[model samples]
Target: MKIAFVINQTHKEKAGFTTTLLAYSALQRGHSVYYIGLADFVYLDHDKIAAHARIIRQIGNIADTQQLIDALKSTSKERVFMDDFDVLWLRFDPVLDMINRPWAAAMGLQFAQLAQKLGVRVLNDPRALVDAENKLYLENFPEEIRPRTIVTRSYDDVKQFFEEQHHEIILKPLKGSGGKNVFLVNKQESKNLKQIVEVICRDGYLIAQEYLPKAQYGDIRFFLLNGKPLIRNGKYASVHRVQSTGEIRSNIHQGAKAQKAVISPEMLQMVEKVAEKLIQDGMYFVGLDIIDDKIMEINVFSPGALLQASELNGEDYAAAIIEDLEKSNGKNKTE
Candidate 1:
């Protein structure tokens, strides 16, 4: 099967990224792989979607991640139609390009939605992604599984939420990621609360969430493929990300350390409820940010960290994922 991963940028993608891991894993299984940057897509007449993508041909002994990275780095890109591939995996981070490339992520999804119309399997359903344009989508889920939250652009509204939450809240951009522009504010002592809200709201809405005390210990990054916990040999495809001391964000890029995760019954229950709806909505691969029993975020577009999860569990989780994709050809293909 031919699979193409839509990424933020070709040069920005590192060897350790989950996109690289999944792409490499697909290649190792002798499947044709392609990497298309967000800006590389082309829409043709007659309702066709195409792109200039870097194709990963099975080069000599491409056995590991590093070798695969080297192979990708050395290869050049070529024009390819989405109809030629079995899967158009949306692995690009929408928030990463929200500033400079504000139009990039949206355009990529627009093309993916077009591709889906052409019978291409667009993972995590591009149409559903349009509804999940930002963090507010979590509000659509079961209220019990999410933290008390409010979205606002006004400073007074944010201040009200802060005070209502007993003077403690986590503030961030509704559309932001990678732990960027996230701030934990205590109303009594926070001098920059106004400025934080101003900065976050400059781009879009500001999300004020009740700061979970468990956040100090970090959150778990749980991977769900096809609306279920991705597991191999009884080990879940998940990782516990412990934040650096004094940090509130548990994102790995923000210096959080990854460790083996414990899948609690509460977590499973929450996942089951969320997955049932997600599967119906076409969210094929997802990552849930779990802090205590509340879900901090639902990562549908470019949900990652499967590599860390695989390593922490000592399991070949990627292999299982690629194999599943192979065996379920028309299962996930969008009409």
Candidate 2:
């Protein structure tokens, strides 16, 4: 099958990371692995999509990992119709980019939607990504599993939320990802409350949630593909991200270290309950931020943790992910 990976620059990604391994595994399986980034696509007014893709030339004999990497690196990219590919993997990590062009992020989804329309399977459907962009998207989970939450920018509303929740609050930017500027506030720090709320609220809405104190230990991340738990043997594809000393946020970007996690029944239940809806929403894959027994975040757009999970479980998740994509494409089954 002709598979195209929409990703960040090659060589820059850490070796053994899931994205790299997936592409490597795909190439090893003799699938035509085309690596395209955000800069590669060409969306047209004719309701058609195209991309100048880095289509890999198959190597006759096997060599080393570097040889395989160099082989795909040597592609002479040319414009091609999106309809030509059997799969268009939207693998770019939009949230981590340095965007001079904000429209580029939105455009990737636009093109992915078009690719799906053209009969190419686009992972983690474009529409779900748009909704997931909002931090309030976490509210879509079962209310019992969530803390007292309010999505509002109004200062009065936030203040009232603080009062209602007894200032047991965690504040965050609704538009932000990877735990940047997520503040855990108590009534004693009321001095900084207004300023923090104002700054985050300026972006869009503020996610004023009752702080889940269980977060002090760490957070667990569960990777789900095609709305099912992506497990290997008996171990699950998951990690317990213990935050580096003094850090409140356990995001890998925020210096969290990945350790093995036992996926508890509660965690599985949460993922199961949310899976069908996520799959229905074009959410081909996602990582759930399990803080305590509750989900703090649903990372749909370019969810990480596969590499961490791989390390923790000593299994090849990147290969598993690529294999799943292959199966999804091969079977062409419906939800």
Candidate 3:
């Protein structure tokens, strides 16, 4: 099977990214793999969508992730039609390019939606992704699992929410990621409330969430493939992220250390609660940021840390994911 991973940028993709893991795993399974950057997509005549993509074939038995990345970087890109691929995985993070290449991520999804219409299996459903362009998508799910949240662009609105919540809130950009603009505010330190709201709302709306007390202990990044936990040999493909001292964000890129996650029954039940809607919406893969019992965030586009999960759990999670993809592809072709 030919699988193409659409990422933010070819040069920016590290060897350790989940995209690289999946791409390398697919290649190891004797499948042709391709890497397409967000800005490389091209729409040709006859409604045919193509990309100036880096296509990798089994060349001299690539051994490691670095070897796979080196092989791709050494090769030049060619224009490959989107319909020629069996799977089109949109792995680009929208917020990564929200400032610099603001138009790039949206264009990538627009192309994915086109590829889906052309019968190429696109993961996470591009159509649903458009609706999930920001944090507000969480509101579509049962309110029970989500934190007390309010989206606003006005400083006064934020102040009201802060007071209502007794002056403890987690302030962040509604359209941001990687903990770039996240801040924690309390009643005593209200001096920065106006400034924080102003800074966060500069780009878009501000998400003022009632501060979850468990956040200090960090959060668990639990991955769901096809709306269920991605597991192998009774080991879940999930990781517990513990934040470094003096940090509120537990993102790996933000210096958080990854460890094994203890998946509680309550967490599984929470997954079950949202699984149906996710499946119906064609969300084939997602990462739920579970802090205690409440979900902090839902990452549908470009969820990472799979390698960490495998390393911590001692399971070949990438192989399992590839196997599932193959099975789903075969099932789809027959139906």
Residue lDDT tens for model 2, 24-134: 667666776777777788877555689988776453563544665666566578888898888787776665553355666777887888888888877767777777666
Q: What is the lDDT of residue 77 in candidate 3?
A: 94
Candidate with better TM-score, 1 vs 3: 3
Top candidate by lDDT: 3
What's the distance in Å from true for residue 51, model 1? 1.2
Error of 2 at 119 (Å): 0.9
Off by over 4 Å in 3: 331-335
Q: If candidate 3 were superposed on the true structure by all CA atoms, what would the RMSD be?
A: 2.0
The deviation in Å at residue 147 for candidate 3 is 0.4
**After best superposition, candidate 1 residue 326: deviation in angstroms?**
1.1
Give the per-residue lDDT digits (tens) of candidate 1, residues 1-335. 78999988887887788888888777767777899999898878757678999987664578777878777777898999888878999988888898898999889888998888889988979888988879999999999999999998899998888888999999988988889989999955578888888888888998989999889988999988899999899988999999998888888988999998888888898888898889988988889999999999999988778889988889988888888897788433221
TM-scores of the models, in the given order? 0.95, 0.88, 0.97
lDDT of each: 0.86, 0.76, 0.89
Q: What is the per-residue lDDT of model 3 for residues 45-77, given as tens digits with 9 covering 90 to 100?
A: 656889999988763578889888888887899
lDDT of 1 at 183: 90
How many backbone clashes are present in model 1?
Answer: 0
